[model samples]
Target: MVFYIIGAIILVGVIAYVAVNHIPKKLHWILSIILLATAGYLLFLINNSIMEPLRFNTEKQIRYTEVIKKLKVIRDAQVAHKTVTGDYTKSGEDLIKFIDTAEFAITQTRNVLVKQKRGLITVDIEKRVVDTIGHEPVRAMFAGKDYKNMLKIASNNNIKFIFSVDEIQKFGNLTEPVFEVKVDKKIVLTGLTDYLIRQELEAATGDEVRGEFISVGSLNEVSENGNWPPYYDKADKNLNKK
Candidate 1:
């Protein structure tokens, strides 16, 4: 509504100028030149206001694209870390190891405090817990497709990762009884986290999936108890079956 009012005012002003342009025949050339220059200047100002925002958006989009690209590296590293350490999650240090310079163009800033968690993985935007896409082959799903914005792919697809500052914590410290990861204190799986776990479970099972997560706070609980799941050696069995 405001925009419409502003546009209407501009239109009215233009029409008024055109009407007045016809009144003075003796100074018509000077009047025409002044009107044209005024119009051009207005257009330049409008263009700067409009295009500057668009250019900023484009630059931000590019940066987010780089983030998603580096996220692939983080995901792959998490998978490998799980394979060796028997933990499906990655710590803050693990993520730093995975992130390259192209992602943020600087060494990662570490913040163990809860408030800083949102800023850890996120460069310019707020942290978002991405939807779980499971372990589907990216080549089969998203390889050839062009994503105009990284948020679409991260929000809609099978990328089983959370963009959080807690991911920057050291792995060994994650399960310490006297310590806690910033985001894991509640032992509650958010809608997004539950969704991610479910995707992972379904992929491990090689069966039809009904939901997204399996054990909601198993790790946080286990950490408190100072014991690993008895099924650690049988994670495949645990993750596969209902």
Candidate 2:
């Protein structure tokens, strides 16, 4: 693109000089060739400038969809792990093992009225109790999902998501289970244009991924949400696959 720009400037100066001076008939063909070549270069540049972004955006959605699909799986797996153990795991292998072997305790909760007396004042109080009714395999919850490769990234087969688990303080110093699984945007968008990747890395818009990493969960908060926009959630959330 830069080469075309430089050649275009030189061609414009030559055309300007030719317009102001007398030219011989022998030079007509040379001028015509230069003009046509310059026009072609300019057209190529214009078309490329227009198409690069379109191609980048197209590939972006495709690769992002693929990676986000796996990310959603990891997120759901982590949620199930937390549900069974009351905490998240940092090890991807442990997460997968838990998904394959864990059991979900089916429980039922109900409210009952109890009589309480406080200093000769008897009143009815509501009490809530929970009971373990049954048990179900955790694997049953992830039916129709991708097995084994749940931790693998779709765009790049060799690359896996960076997984971590920790606790975050909630209201009034209460800590809750938190886990984060992420991969760099550059890795996900590999072999693409560099400048566009830089622009994506600096993305701060709410509709975009909003950071350098396409991640799920947060170490700073207790959210199971991915950093992607709701457009992905519409598909991944409704797909019925963990």
Candidate 3:
């Protein structure tokens, strides 16, 4: 809008200047036509320059929103995998299979009376005297029905998101395991226009960064946090308003 306004002001100023100079009556029509054409072209450039970034910003927000959702699903699956297997899987294929077929042990504990050496004592024990009472399918933990689709990014169907698990040392003695799920932004914004893609990458990293992936959790540290910026929350809040 500001671009349009500025272009209009410049256009009007040029026409006013041409009219005030009044070189010749015959030349007025030619000058006015040329000025109008120039103004139209300038407006086109201005509108494209301003609107392209806005369009790219919006597209990026949407893509990231979906990417974030998928990343969360991966996180949940990883957590569930860790819970049942005592370790995270590095393969995306294995993760998806686990989500589709694996079941987690469900156990319950309660206080019960026990015979002690001196007297009767109350003790907390598993409901069935076993660690697991029953099992729940991993799919039950997530709302989405299709585990395969969840493994891929929403934008570019050709590319599958990456997942990896590694061990990191803590306290210089103990080693802890961590997993990271990632999807490249280039693949996420693949179908977008060239200009929009360029704008999105520039805005995201402030440079011509390649192979930038949005991810959750960390392979280098014992953390299950995401790498997205806080502005994602703001963008989601604004979207919810609409």
Candidate 4:
């Protein structure tokens, strides 16, 4: 639309400049002024149309990066929970409590060779042995973490992220556990301009995005996958692959 308007303005400017040469001096001045005003309005429209998407995408990148960070934290916490409980939990409160108060056994193992003496000969055999070395608290595992802020969206503190876990029956009637953490795009993109939000939704819908929620893990399967593009990983080398 902006391009079309600018093209029309230029065409009109050319025609007006040519026609004004045959008009009286006062009429020429009026027509030139009108053309300049139209050109100024077209410039404003051009700038607006060009800048709006750039601004939207910039803010989207910033907000999505923070959202991915939070999702990674959630993924780590869920993985730890599963490590201790054999399955993930659906409650953020329970997850936070587990993070704060759980303990996991740390085992020490060593490979040893057993030697047996029989009269004047010795036979050596290799074996593995395991021992309970110690236990470490989950909080210690995640020391220096800000537990209070883990479940909230960064842009809008009021909106807590959504987390869920489920058990699904896989092949041969075997069951497996899966977990998912999610936040609404609107929640993460809060404080952005309304125009940007609408554009985001429209683009998402056009692309057939599954939900308004950006998420990691699968509720329908036993996969710990995230809903991010390949380019996202390419862009952020330090991003956790949990």
Off by over 4 Å in 3: 1-25, 110-130, 191-211, 230-242
For every model shown, the clashing-pair count is: 9, 0, 0, 0
On TM-score, who's better, 1 or 2? 2
lDDT of 3 by residue, 157-184 (tens): 7666787889988887988889988877
Per-residue C-alpha lDDT of model 2 across residues 35-139, encoded as one tens digit per residue: 787788788887897899899989998988888888888888888988889998888888888988999999999999999999989999999999999999998
lDDT of 2 at 171: 79
| TM-scores, one per candidate | 0.31, 0.85, 0.71, 0.73
Residue 27 in candidate 3, Cα distance off native in Å: 3.7
What tens-digit string does per-residue lDDT give for candidate 1 at 1-242?
23644664586477558757665666667766766766776666667656755564454334334333434344444444443444544354543443221121122343342333354563343444434333432223233323223222332343333332122334766542111222121122223234333433344343321123212222333322111223332533665585
Candidate 4, 1-242: lDDT as tens digits: 55677686877768686766677776776777767777877877788778877887787877777777677677878889999989998988888899888988899889999998878999998889999888899888676656657776646676677877788888898889998888777766777678667666655433222357778899887767677665555544654543
| Alpha-carbon deviation at 47 in model 2, angstroms | 0.4
List where candidate 2 sits over 4 angstroms from the true fold: 15-23, 110-128, 171-173, 237-242
lDDT-superior candidate, 1 or 4: 4
Instruction: Please identify model 4 stretches exceeding 4 Å from their true place.
Output: 1-25, 109-131, 190-199, 202-211, 230-242
TM-score of 2: 0.85
Best by TM-score: 2
The C-alpha RMSD in Å for every predicted model, in order, reads: 23.4, 3.5, 6.4, 6.2
Model 4 is weakest, by summed lDDT over 10 consecutive residues, at 202-211
TM-score of 4: 0.73
Residue 107 of candidate 4: its Cα lDDT?
A: 92
